[model samples]
Target: MRKLSCLLTGLMLTAVPGVCMAQMTADTRLGVGHSVTDADLRAYFSIPPSGKGLPAGSGTALQGETVFTESCAACHGEQLQGNMAPGIGADKLIGGRGSLATNNPVKTTESYWPYATTLFDYVKRAMPFNAPGSLTDDQVYSVVAYILAQGKIIKADETLDATTLPKVKMPNRDGFIADPRPELSLYR
Candidate 1:
């Protein structure tokens, strides 16, 4: 019994170091995540309302209609009225102008969005229902131009790029008031 007790004690003490070494190796973070490269950061970078970080590409409303028909029409509908398919609820993109004051105000892009640049950023980040971030910069710009033109916000022939997109005024541009509280990184 004494020998058996010592033998068990010896095994436990021997096993403790091995377990500790395994934990220590895990803390080393070897074979974990790779360091973030410039390209990596650029891939998921945010586009501000000022049009900063917008990629270098140009697209017109005419070109945007084609892209929209192919990629966006499935969820957004042919006339951008949105699809309420079972679980999929796509938002409408136009109309609702001056309806914010009404009880039945529809919060479409033309009536709610404060900036055209924001529209471009949203399409760039997420769109096409199933395939998000798949559209090229030109496609994104064109789509924004088409939606804006459809909403009568801009001329159909107008081209939208980083510089021109920011300059395009939205109907509700002054609708939103700036936050009085100090900016916080978490909110951003």
Candidate 2:
């Protein structure tokens, strides 16, 4: 009787995963989650450096400061010094200007990033450390504006949107050389 029970439990354990996988791969439904749709893909699409895919909303540095305090300060630090926690080491967002040429260069946002648009793209795609892609476009824009303002990269009053964001040049704007390789020409 004991041998029979052990054999049944082992078979059940092995069979459960297969059944779940089968359900997950089925065309109709997974019984647990709905299939991804085109709209969902569009929601998570990348915003290129040209600001081509940036949403219509806009935000200011003041508004961004509030949003940052609520969503980003825990991981990135209240002053953007970066969290010192073991696994949650968020990067410092401000300063580090003119250090790129030095041996101990501190690559903060103001000093390292080549384009402000890329900042917007990164924040939109992955941020808040815990819940990525959860912030609305306005919230993302506000946080970006705040960070840039803190770094002195842009005026605190400067409003960032699709048109203006791509124009806000970074301190290292001219530092990056264009890729000379032919295979990567399409990206240029």
Candidate 3:
């Protein structure tokens, strides 16, 4: 009787996993929201520097101004100067050009960000302090263009898309240097 009980328990454990695996591998489309299609998989992936995974849609600085005013102005000033209110310390996004040499260097988007693609990526992933991860791809591009244009990084007419976004040069593009420290730890 003990041997039979042990055998049944082992069989149940093995069979349960097999059944679960089969269900997971089987018609995933009919299951809960965990099942994802190719399109769904594509949406969550990050866009590379080369814009390999860039989603469709385009935006201009003009349209971006509206979006920024509506969603961003409450915190980052209407002019994109960042949130300076008491207790809120949002960084400025415009000026700081040619200030890196000074004792007090201002690191705004125009002055510090290395790549234009980073702006789009960051805005898409996080922004609008009150709410994060809410902006769409097109909105991010448009907001990036608006901020860049305001900072004099790019011309007003230049539209930021996957192709052109990578091309827009940033002032501090060459400011960053690779870390020289060894990655492996030798702590005591």
Q: Estimate each model's TM-score.
A: 0.77, 0.75, 0.74
Best by TM-score: 1
Error of 3 at 32 (Å): 4.7
* 1 against 2, candidate with superior TM-score: 1
- Estimate, for each residue in 15-110, the C-alpha lDDT of model 1 and write its tens digit: 553232112222244666443343444454467678877789999999999999999888888999988787676878999999998999989999
**What TM value does model 3 have?**
0.74
lDDT scores in order: 0.79, 0.79, 0.75
Candidates sorted by TM-score, best first: 1, 2, 3
* lDDT tens readout by residue for model 3, 24-50: 233556764453344543444456666
Ten-residue region with minimum lDDT total, candidate 1: 18-27
Query: Candidate 2: what lDDT?
Result: 0.79
Which portions of model 1 miss their true places by more than 4 Å? 1-35, 182-188
Q: Give per-residue CA lDDT, model 2, range 62-177, as digits (tens).
A: 99999999999988899999887888778788988988999988888888998888899889878877888899989998999999999998999988888889989888999877
lDDT for 99 in candidate 2 is: 89
